[model samples]
Target: MTNPYTTAPMPPQPPLRPAPKWARKRYVLPALALAFFIGIGAGGASGDDAKTTAAKPKSASPRPTVTVTTTAEAREPEPAPTVTATKTVKVTATPAPDTGTVADDDSGADVYYANCSEAHAAGAAPVHRGEPGYASHLDRDNDGVGCDS
Candidate 1:
């Protein structure tokens, strides 16, 4: 007899058994796939005769056509008006007086600036080599222009 105050030892568990070969995923999946393919093939074969008997060509009706007509009236072009008049008046030409500015000089050498500061003060900073007030001393980089800064 077991003592009421003492607990009994648990029995050893049974060893695990492997799944059956037919019940494994590898075998069962392929078997189910084969059965599914067979079922589809049987169903398609039995429906072939019904499909062939029920298939009938539909009758075609002629599509409607549309016609459009347009007309334009022809008219002769109108002749332009002709008028002639003659008048004579005497005219006099006057020469403009020269203001004698640097714009009148072809060389533009008359326009002068002593330094870049003077050129900037005159609001003519970036003077090109050909333009007025451009000097080599003002252009430290000697890139043809003067007072670039």
Candidate 2:
């Protein structure tokens, strides 16, 4: 029996070499050439060729213009003038005071309305001596009360 799969020996690679200076010279020459041309063009001076003359001040008129005047005849004196002055006065009115009834010293009335009005109206509580339902509710000394408390 013959072997169908067989391999041959490979050849060895060459050693690595260092880069030569001339390898970069190709790129450097073009850059230097561009910079030299740019310097030469930028260094040249440019100016306008047209010649300019100095501006002169304008001359004034030989003589100044003057206005003319005319005179009138004088007249005789007349009678002295009379003046009369009149003065006016202004008046303002004050408003009338209110005569309506005012609820002063309203402690008892306010207390009755706020705490006892509902109970009294519903008839749930009698107007007793110390209870809010009673007219005598504020009697702190309790002699069968009224605002005396």
Candidate 3:
């Protein structure tokens, strides 16, 4: 006795799956768009870029004017200083008159006794003409009257 259907074997079959649509178009279009935008942006930034400038100084307007007033007082004149002068004088005093002159009959003694003796004896008269009693005594020089000399 012998078994049949053992002469050959069949190959194994692989599993099946779904495929993506436009997959290749997807990466190529995006990469090209990215490169185009980047080149345009870089070219615009590099060549003939716009520059900003500062404004110029303008002329200034004229300033307003102001006025001021002041008052002054007149000066007064200065007064002159006062000055005084002093002088020395020599004064001579005369004696009282007697009854006789220096050379009269009674002589100078009569004049002394009549007019001067009373005050002379009391030590009241000065000794000489220039002295206090000189005026009270007789005319010693025989000039004109008692004490006149």
Compose the digit string of candidate 3's lDDT tens values, residues 1-149.
54566665656778785456688678888999999999988766533333322234557999998988888888888888878764433333344466555633332332233345443453444344433333433666544344331
TM-score of each: 0.28, 0.20, 0.19
Task: Name the top lDDT candidate.
Answer: 1
Q: Per-prediction RMSD in angstroms?
A: 17.7, 26.7, 38.8
Model 3 residue 6 CA deviation (Å) reads 23
**Local lDDT at 135 for model 3:** 47
Candidate 3: give its CA RMSD in angstroms: 38.8
**Residue 100 CA error for candidate 3 (Å)?**
99
Query: Which stretches of model 1 miss by more than 4 angstroms?
Result: 1-108
- Full ranking by TM-score: 1, 2, 3
**Candidate 2: stretches off by over 4 Å:** 1-7, 39-45, 49-149
Q: Which ten residues in a row have the lowest lDDT in candidate 2?
A: 87-96
Write the candidate numbers in order of decreasing lDDT: 1, 2, 3
lDDT of each: 0.73, 0.51, 0.51
The digit string of per-residue lDDT tens for model 2 on 13-41 reads: 89898778898897899999999999988
